[model samples]
Target: MGTEVQCTLCPTECELENHQVGGCKVRINRDGTLYSLVYGKPCAVQVDPIEKKPFYHVLPGAKAFSIATVGCVLGCKFCQNWQISQALPEESEHRDLDPDEVVRGALYYGCQTVTYTYTEPTVFYEYMYDTALLVRKFGLLNSVHTCGYINQEPLRELAPLLNAADVDLKAFTEDFYGRICGGRLKPVLEAIVTLREMGVWLEITNLVIPTLNDDPKEIRDMCRWLVENAGPDTPIHFSRFFPYYKLKNLPPTPIETLNMAQQTAREAGLRYAYIGNIRQSGENTYCPSCGKLLIERIGYFVKQNLLQEGACPYCKSSIAGVWDQT
Candidate 1:
């Protein structure tokens, strides 16, 4: 038997023998050594608005050079990017962009941050790590939109490099996580708390899938937990879910449901709760102190920003976000 090694990058902790691949499909064990198959081979690359990453609070209106490799830690049924997230390295089309090239691309495109997004960045750890070092060295920021399914050591090591993270807190229940996302919920919650503790700017996204995880009580519970653990200043985006992938049978989340979720978050003491995936007033940022409009946005486009040095321009309340790159 060949030597077996355990991949501890995520909570799944896949132990693989020689020539065996991990659950993420991006890491392979070869002759007693583990190798990341997707390093420096991102399948998706784009210059997107920072708000497209749904990072309303982080350098609003700035562009992000986003990149992602093929593979993910979890298999969410409703994943919008399932085409790349669920593909094997050999099955996907990718670019030969190395870490230094990635940083250069961000600079070339005049992006304020380099984002690891579209798929799980955790699976592309080595690539993200190396690129993040260069991104920081070049005076640019690093951000990620992730599922928050990473282990503690790696997360801590990567936290310092990350300027902001938009975590998909898919649902509040372990059953929902297991049934809908093929993962557990505890580690994600732990990761959220750990990120906050490590001083990384954190945000949360919950895609409201009509019957699956849109319970009002559950939303309240999730918001309360965020207030208690991640703090009330943490912005939570309740996104409307449209039928896609394995979840096509379900109807799109009712507008009322998203509204209820936003109300629930505020009632649970969360200060900055926003609705996503639809055009509404919820997309704008308002001062949690004096209820003054801080930033006006329209579909990822910032029309006007009223924040002065990360604070409300009118009331001067310190808004919680990476509003300035410096």
Candidate 2:
């Protein structure tokens, strides 16, 4: 192994030798040049409710045409979508769809948004970037479901085209990130700040695993950081972790733990904190000012919306989200 070339996309900054792929598995060094193997070859494509992205604040009940290629930068042990995220291009079933075709597919499906989801979109950067441009040109919104492991410069370039994003914060500690996810915490936190600063409608998901990252104090600290950096209005979803992938040995996150984490977020000055995976009243959106329910969601479907345009009817408090113009 000689003649190393570094990938500046994420903090991993994987330096690849000849014929070596980066940590993502999709980006490889071929004869000293870096190339993305899974470009335009999306393995998963489906139309889903925008709420399913758990982007509760953006385009409420709109349908999003979601697409994903193989590979991811982070290898979280409890990843539910590990089949696609951990697989290489050749290891997954994929279909050929260029940027233009992806835009067309969204229109054909009567979707208001195009989402890069199911797997980490950052590893399929080239494809997502190109498709995002076309998606904007077609007047369709662009969104991403990601792990938030990315560099600032690339995120800056990608931000303008993005209308919404649901980032998986995963955990609060560097110890948990390194030991459990094969990644770090700082870069993800940096990326979240970058996204928020860019005016992208952002939401965060933290998979609460029992006996791991379920500490209420640690969650409160995480919530405080988000409130300080991303704003108190930023929606935080503390998702339940099922036994999956490499972490199948661990028990699922308890409902009480998820509730405690949500309570911790609210106590830490967060305006919106939600519980996910298993349904409860926390799935709906309410006004932080008057305690009036603004949007009532039944699972992934919006059952009722009581907002007058974008603000709560009772209190007229401005909800921090892209509620209209989908």
Candidate 3:
């Protein structure tokens, strides 16, 4: 079998012929045409907190109607959602929720956003892009929790409708991304730059796995790069790695690591840094201009909201996030 057809969604650019799939198991070449088997097909759907997306910056505390299709473009060894993220279209249980149905569900669930999450939306491009167009007209924001792994053309086209996106900057080193994620680091960086340049509200998540991608120097480098490329105001969530999927033998990331990561980010010039999947005291979201808690969160619950007209009510300093016009 000669590999000839090209897939430009990521840097992989897997060339393939009929009966062949790209580096991602989901995209296939059938009789000379590339098609996504997951299109218009959803395997999981629910309403979750925008905070759960670790998007503490956008619509904080609002419920977001979330959807995910089976199959992932990049196969990560420590995938937390591998059950849904790594499966064939025919392998997972699904709901026939079309774009129209998705809009209805968001409104029904009293959600202000529809999140294409739990898997890489880039692989299911048509399904997500079309759904985003429809949902925006109904006053619903389109949010994506993505790996930032896509070609510039598709990313530019989709950036307009996106109200917010939480992109994962997996690691700073190419070796980590190449070996673990089955992806390249450069395209992900490019996509993040393009998103910020396109004026899309953005957040970044870095899942620190022990002995894999968690070098203090690497984390510092990642944070520095984020501040330089995506802007210092971009919210960065340093999520604690829980052993799952193929990483069952590794112990969960310690609380100290998450805190240290957040501190490193702050020291590196990130204005808003957070630690996820851990319970304990954390100094999250203080006014960059004046030290005051703008939005205090502990374990996914918003304990205090100190914003008045999107600015800190205490010291009248401007906060860097979208606040409801309440």
Task: Give the TM-scores of the predictions, in the order they appear.
Answer: 0.99, 0.97, 0.95
User: Which pairs of residues have clashing backbones in candidate 1?
Assistant: none
Comparing candidate 1 with candidate 2, which one achieves the higher TM-score? 1
- Regions more than 4 Å wrong, model 2: 1-3
lDDT-best of 2 and 3: 2
Residue 25 of model 2, lDDT score:
89
Query: Of the candidates shown, which would achieve the greatest lDDT relative to the real structure?
Result: 1
Candidate 1: worst 10 consecutive residues by lDDT?
308-317
Q: What's the CA error at residue 291 for candidate 2, in Å?
A: 1.0
lDDT of 2 by residue, 19-129 (tens): 899989899988778899988899998999998888988878999999999899998888899998899787778999999999889999999999999989999999999
TM-score of 1: 0.99
RMSD (CA, Å), candidate 1 to true, equals: 0.8
User: What is candidate 2's CA lDDT for residue 233?
Assistant: 91
Please report, in order, the local distance difference test score of every candidate based on alpha carbons: 0.94, 0.91, 0.86
